[model samples]
Target: MRRAISRLKPLWLVPILLGALLGVLGVLDVVPDFVAAVPPPVIVTAIALGVVLFAVHPRAEAHQPHRMAAPVRGRWAALNTPGQQLPSHGSRFLGQYAAVDILRPTTPATPAKLRKAWRNSTPQEYPSFGEAVYAMAPGVVTATWSRSRDHRARNTWQSLVFMLVLEGSLRSVAGRAALLGNHVIVRHADGTAAVYAHLRRGGVAVQKGQQVGVGNQLGEVGNTGNSSEPHLHVHLMDRANPNAAAGLKMTWTDITRSEEIEPSLAEIAKQPEPNAVLSMPRNGEIFEA
Candidate 1:
């Protein structure tokens, strides 16, 4: 029961509560008689919405020991895990993916103060803001995009609410360039494409159709697209076009840990673990490449 609740997003809970509340009100005669016709439709709509939300909810995948070359050098940590947190809720096409954000271990994991006060901050404030992104696997460059603006970090309640309500349509409104921001798609050797997203302006170093080896420089991480801070957003898709592809499972190689785990456990006062191995880094766990 605890685990299930953890998987649910707060915004998704609203409609569910509304549906149940309407049912209770109808039973208690809390509403007007003219409103008698309201409960059934409202209840049904809420149920439908509930099903959609559940269906679209980010997927928590069973961790497989995936071994891939380290995509970035130096010490870094993982946020939004495939272990419990569904990185992104959309699970169809580019949506059915387990996305992970990689940032340097030295960066601020959360807003230093109120979540909203940092809304106008710059990406350079974070350590991972300028770190270079590397190829997850050897493959040819399939596609690239770099048009989104790296607006201030959306740490305010207002921006969070707005993102919950309308962020879904950002990709459609701004084209594929909107959500991922300055991303590159490499046709990975394992029959999937590695999407390197949220890169800095002019950070991309490889071109489309160019062959790259594992660990090749793709670009420096930046605050672009739908990102709230600077970090590398990556996911594996079955096809070159994320919109038409399904997300594939990925396992990291060459991962190791130290005395501390997670950002809050201990001040990760050092770099990532030097010897990389195959494992999943939990939300706060740090790893060095």
Candidate 2:
């Protein structure tokens, strides 16, 4: 019972339902004068409850790093990496505490080309788009989705502002499926799960209940859901249900090369060895596994 309770989201809904009920009663003219006077105190109490819920919400354990194989092959650059900060996506909600985004760098590796690709390229023009996404470890598929259409890139300042202010808000309200786009959830025998998000529409190659080994292809990367561009989003979680799961630290067991690229783009705290056996590439780092 305690475990189940911990898995549940915070009780913010209680105040929301109360507010809605009071509004309905007011519209129906069923609220008495005494009850009409009750709204002020009720609103105050609701605000306090919201504050308490936010303070006490369960957060991911940072020390529990889950080691697995790299989910993609060849050259890739890391972004929003936990190696740079905890709650990598700026929040622990939705099991993204230690999530990472990766994309293939453009050829010639020029700043001009990178900016142009990010600001104006279509999904198919990016190297990472349609590239195979692999299972990080042996697991049974618990969920699969492949219907969300790949949207345009939001890498430019103007588009990013719109995404963060408007589209992101709507996606959050629409829930995990809308935020993650075409995705797959795989649960390992130890109970931890891995999520592969922003997959290409109609690209999912596996179904729920199927077993997958490390390096097995699950789908191709795409610029879907609440993404800024065509990149693969990977994260580990305590469970398969992302709504309740807490994020877990993740590392790659087969990283063969790690190179820091364009430190001006994003800061890099520590330089990982070129051939570290097990590693988590920091932001601005290009790595091969």
Task: State which candidate has the highest lDDT.
Answer: 2
Clash-forming residue pairs, model 2: none
In order of appearance, the predictions have TM-scores of: 0.67, 0.78
Q: Candidate 2: which stretches are off by over 4 Å?
A: 1-6, 10-57, 60-64, 108-120, 262-278
Query: Which lDDT tens digits does candidate 2 get at residues 66-117?
Result: 7799999888888778766666777766677788988887655322323533
Local distance difference test values of all predictions, in order = 0.65, 0.76
Name the lDDT of candidate 1: 0.65
Taking the tens digit of each residue's C-alpha lDDT, what string does model 1 give over 45-90? 7777764554442233454534577678877777654533444333
Off by over 4 Å in 1: 1-66, 85-96, 106-113, 116-119, 168-174, 264-278
